[model samples]
Target chain A: MSILINKDTRVICQGITGKVGMFHTKGCLEYGTQMVGGVTPGKGGTTVEGLPVFDTVAEAVEQTGCDATMIFVPPAFTADAILEAVDAGLKTVIAITEGVPALDMVYVYEVVKRTGVNLVGPNCPGVITPEECKIGIMPGYIHKKGPVGVMSRSGTLTYEAVWQLSNLGLGQSTCVGLGGDPIVGTSFIDLFKMYQADDDTEAILMMGEIGGTAEEEAAAFVKQHVTKPVAAFIAGRTAPPGKRMGHAGAIISGGKGTATEKVAALEDAGIEVANGPADMGAALQRAMKRGR
Target chain B: MKVHEYQAKQILRDAGVAVPEGIVAKTPADAAAAFDKLGGSIAVVKAQIHAGGRGKGTLKEHPDQRGVQLVRSREEAEQVAARLIGNTLVTIQTGPEGKVVNQVLVEAGCNIARELYLGIVLDRSAAKPVVMASSEGGVEIEKVAEETPELIFKEHFTPDRGLDDFQVRKLCSKLNLAGASVSSAMRFMKGLCRVYSELDCSMAEINPLVVTADGELMALDAKISFDDNAIFRHPQLKELRDRTEEDPYELRAGDAGLSYVKLEGNIGCLVNGAGLAMSTMDLIKLHGGEPANFLDVGGGANVQQVTEAFRILLDDKNVKAVLVNIFGGIMRCTTIANALLEAYKSVGFNVPLVVRLEGTEVEQGRKIIADSDVDIITAEGLTDAAKKVVAAATGATA
Candidate 1:
């Protein structure tokens, strides 16, 4: 019943030999995810944390029968890694790499669409379906197994929202970090539709920021097709204009992509908008109450 | 990452767009040369920087033989250039910090009928470059958007597909089609899109495109920003980067290969994950401590990024303390400790450093830093780390 991933998803690690990749792969294994094998370009046949390594994602996929890849390669190579995964016919990919250029991501997007493969992030925190399967750098202990599905573009905002929701006993069925890059592989609309179809997911907590029309488009999408209740928060309401803050997409360009605009759009779609990031959990609770 | 107006236009022109003739100047001599290049009768002398307020300060001039006039100068353009050559121009548009002018753009002034703002960038939701057109061009499209949003039309175009002719014509008509200038604007838009896509730009904008008194659409102002991550591919962009305009610490941090974007804050943020770094920035603000910068050494940071992050924290001069928040995940705390020691070795610090460590080998990480010769303090949790950093910044006893 979980959204994008469950316990049975076969996972392969790209850049499994890298320090960060190896650490997180071990973490995924500790969480009891099916860490089948890994691909490290030149370090084929090596073992990292007891997982077999192959040269390419295709080799790892062919040898291990893994179709889901979590990429931890550096920025310059992440786009290639994504393309490799998609070309290998991977069904789902979660790229843990940040600082990927928008140009690189645009190509990755074209490849994903061309290959019909789903890519999660270029700046995201990765996805975790609570106790079912964890595939990111989030604190596993803070997340609890539950029914609400959380999707966010910003990492800290996502973390803050999840921490608040977890503390309030409103655990997430899956919390997907869509990444905060100006260009991302998945939008809120994509995740919203998935959450809407997951029967185990009762409500949604979507965290958006002041950059891009992703939230606006998602709001428009929800107004038409999304049946489940959505509670959302758009960050940087009071943030200074034109400054990127942290995320590449968090800029207030030419006065558009403001928090006010996103919230207004989300509210107009009949979804409840939280007052701020701090109230996201309670906002979800209220939306759940009203929807029921 | 934003390039100046004349540069954007020149890039547009090089890309085969019909843009007004312009020249870049670095000094009064260069401005005078540019003035001569534009036939010296009438030309626009503007300060070249990364912001949007040349109309206000000594940044703009029309130097003539008489003296320096902001709008009607021929000689005063020299004074404008002289005054701005080695000076800084502070504007609300440039954020809390202002941009330094090492160059000035001198161009043939345009006759105006209509002014508009047009920009192309990656659409946040659609994940493609979206072109935005506004009739209220020059002053601030944000104000235009706030007061009148319908006038703003966003045309989404994929990079691989390039610009659509129909969309370009449609946009030109909205910018107000009267003459063949509609074609000129369309040409400029498409050219800009080409440069945008080819350059791997994060944003490219032309604000206040004036329909000159001569019935010609002219881009009076331009701004261009390249994706910093992509700058490595283009050596020309790397050369164009004015590190002098950035925080010395931030520049140094970048040199250290860390992702650090300076912010207007007092609390220094050091985090492992970019998402966590963002959350730390927000939390710092929520807790009443402005983050000095968004520093993400990225996951699996080693000694170099950690120490560079620390040195960057100290370099902020405004920062009174440092908040090292690392959620180790698979990254061991011991590595964090080694990094702290390494950073301390590279740059000795006197300010308070708060280390918040969690995950595998957490105690080992703590032990490494605690055992280091460098003074290090531990936080009970992230919130506690934040509070401590705030306390240290404000000289409080919390």
Candidate 2:
């Protein structure tokens, strides 16, 4: 009962000829994700790791009947790749590429909103449905199929949380990395809604960092819409202001998007916020028990 | 990615935006020559540093020297420049260890009828670029937004199409601009918006968009930052990067395709992804330890890059212990382990090291590390790793 993907979700690869695309496509295939075909603009009619490659996304979708596409194109072409996927009528697109310009993402958001297609990340670690399907670049060994759904704005941090939860025997239903970019296609609100609707997701473990008002808005959405128990963790509590902190979106500009503000907002919504990354597993455990 | 005020003004000027006539001077003689060339009785000599509040900043060595000073004569301009150049100027933005002033902008002073703030910033909530205007111009816009939010007005604009007529009109009316000043403001804003979109700038701020007593709109001060990701599309913009403004280690790390930040701790960290790097730092602090730096080798870093990352961490003088946390996803743990051993062989492991690895081929990764002759401590989990590193760093038992 994964929110976005399962074993049956057929996936096509965008920029499947690239080095990263080749490596992760093989990984995804090994994890049991249905690799239908791939799209490389000029390198159509080729094969990568035994998967057929088409010139355009439309052709790949037509020939393979794939419903989803995972993008590993470089930054310069990522926006266009997303637009191509949306234009071709792909229902879900997961972009693992990092460093797509913020302005480009602004336009992508406008287009995706109008088309009503779900887009995961341009600088994220993709999404995983544990054991059933994995589209992102997360370690598959640690993730186990379970009732707790996890979401984060970071790549390795998501792995850390998921690993802790799995070690605690509280595996995740689906884990989504929302990308650590200033502009992202999906927010915590978007995932919270999906997790709430998914019957298998008994509790939600949300990990956020100081950045945009996405966390605040998600808190508002959870208060109004999500009835499922949710545990939250916000990183960069000890980080200084104005530093980029590795992620382009991790800066606290104009005194906004501080860790304290996000923690306060989440607590205001009756969600338990963890003290640190290590405490999140226990926090989710408490939230799940309360929900039961 | 932040360009100096003079450089930002040059960009805005090239984009047809009206900016103050100025010349960059590196020395006192150059300042005097620039003042003479401008042929103004009064000129403003401003220090060129990548920070705000320069007008109020004072030199660290000379208490009487201000970063920005008004000079009535060419000699005064030379004197101000002499006091500023080769001296550290401390501003509110720059910490106590202020940036050294290598250059100064000498410009003909303007007769200001009124001071107004104008800026174009990428608004994440709206998912668009917004033009922000406030009557309280010269002061800090952040303070104004915090104390009197209503004083500031914003108009969101699409990047491809740029500022719409309606948005420009709304901006003018909201700022109580009318008549010739209205057209002047409109032209200035349109040009600024063009610069923002065409150059792919994340933020373009004009702290004091001045209206001269003669009814002309001019950008008195400009601070612009380009999107690092989009810098490839605009190759010319990359030339504006001032390596002097950034930490040497961070700049080198960037060149090596690693994200690194030096901190005031003794425990060096190498991890994958930004979030995990930060979490590792936080955990190190939680366990009574301070992290010397934050280094993310990224998701696709190869063995060579990992070795370089190790070299970078070891380069930090304060590093007494090092922690390498890798959660292999697309990056293999075995690859990282091989790189770590190779880096140790080349750089020499002079510090206590702790490693916690998980994910693909992790068993093989652990076995390689175990088989290696490098003195390394492996942890079972993040918490245990933190404790081990902290204990090693502080000379306490694990």
lDDT of 2: 0.89
Docking class of 1: acceptable
Candidate of highest TM-score = 2
Per-residue lDDT of model 2, residues B1-398, tens digit only? 88999999999889888998999999999999999999989999999999999989999999888888889999999999999999999999988899999999998899999899999988878889999999999999989999999999999998888887778888888887878888887789989999999889989999899988887789999999999888888999888888898778898899999998877898999998888888888889988899888788988788688778878888877788999999887788898888888888888778889999988789999999999998999998888999999989987322
Tens-digit lDDT track for model 1 on A109-189? 877877777789977778998887888777677688998999987665576678778889988899999987777788888
Candidate 1 chain A lDDT trough over 10 residues, lowest sum:
A236-245
Q: Provide C-alpha RMSD values for all models, in order.
A: 4.4, 1.6
Native-to-model Cα distance after best TM-score fit, residue A87 in candidate 1, in Å: 4.1
DockQ of all models, two decimals each? 0.37, 0.75
